[model samples]
Target chain A: SAVISQKPSRDICQRGTSLTIQCQVDSQVTMMFWYRQQPGQSLTLIATANQGSEATYESGFVIDKFPISRPNLTFSTLTVSNMSPEDSSIYLCSVAPRLGNTQYFGPGTRLTVL
Target chain B: TQLLEQSPQFLSIQEGENLTVYCNSSSVFSSLQWYRQEPGEGPVLLVTVVTGGEVKKLKRLTFQFGDARKDSSLHITAAQPGDTGLYLCAGVGHNNAGNMLTFGGGTRLMVKP
Candidate 1:
């Protein structure tokens, strides 16, 4: 399993502002993914971040609202733009070292939009 | 897109009671994993069942994969208050791109002392 960490474990921001969550993995991995969990609900995948390329967003997720960056194998970022109260949720990152697939996750970033 | 349906959306029982949570899907999965999550924290992996009919145990928790590889279950013997949390099951298919996980609706369990 990979040791994953997310910066700014939590934050409170204004509705119109933007917040960027950073994810760092201890080991280099080929696949990294971002997810959103609404209160008392299941996780919804936001996108798959590929190193040195654009992110692949899931259905109903737009790049303009959630811009992702994966500059390298071990690091990625997901920025929530023009945030709204509906956007307040836990943002998590996961990594899978191989294709045979079980993913390890970061602690998660709890975001609150006021 | 594959979907996993989990049953018993909510459960509450005495500390000594036993219970089981089920995850069913029509689509086959290459692997399935169970996780436990507490309040205000990320989920911690409990176990992974890869092969059909596979069973794995950890302490008081037991996980079993269905023979068709499209279903799974988690059973707890002598449930404890410490076992109270959200239980989630995720499935991964062979054709899933980049290790994407299809998560179940989740079962919220509360064991009272």
Candidate 2:
């Protein structure tokens, strides 16, 4: 299992503002993913942060809205741009150390956009 | 799109009672994983079932994968207050990239003392 941590454990942002959540892993990983969980709902994959490359986003998500940056193997960031009330959700980062290994998640960042 | 449907969206029971949560999907999955999430925290993986008709046990928790690989279940015996959390079921499909997961609507279990 990998030890993962996320910054800004919880935050309240005004509409139109942007917030970047950072994910740090204890060791290098091959894959890192970002997920969103709305109130009273299950998690949805937002994107896959690829090292030194553009992230692969899901169907309903776009790069302009949830931009991701994976500068290195152990760290990544997801920025919720132009936030709105609808964007208020718990953002989580997970790391898959290798193929066929279980992904470990960081303590999520709870964002409330007012 | 493949979708997982979990039953008993909300379950409230007293301590020591037994309960079961079901996750069903029409599409077949390569593997299925179960997770438990507490308030204000990310989910923690409990177990992963890879083969069809497989049954894995962890202490009081028993997990079973349907023969078709399209369904799974989690059964807990003698539930405890610590068992209060949201249980989620996720499936890994053959066509998904990077082992992307499709999640089921969670089952929120609250065990009273």
RMSD of 2: 1.0
**Runs off by more than 4 Å, candidate 1:** B94-96
Per-residue lDDT value at A54 in model 2: 94
Cα shift from native, residue A52, model 2 (Å) = 1.3
* Best of the candidates, lDDT: 2
Clashes of each: 0, 0
Q: Kindly list the per-residue Cα lDDT of model 2 for residues B1-113, writing each as its tens digit.
A: 89999988999999999999999999999999999999988899999999999999999999999999999999999999999999999998633346778899999999999
Per-model chain B TM-scores are: 0.96, 0.96
Candidate 1 structure quality by residue, lDDT tens digits, B1-113: 89999988999999999999999999999889998888877788899999999999999999999999999999999999999999999998633355678899999999999
Full-model lDDT for every candidate = 0.91, 0.94
> TM-score per candidate, in order?
0.96, 0.98
Please report, as a residue range, the 10-residue window in candidate 1 chain B with the lowest summed lDDT.
Answer: B92-101
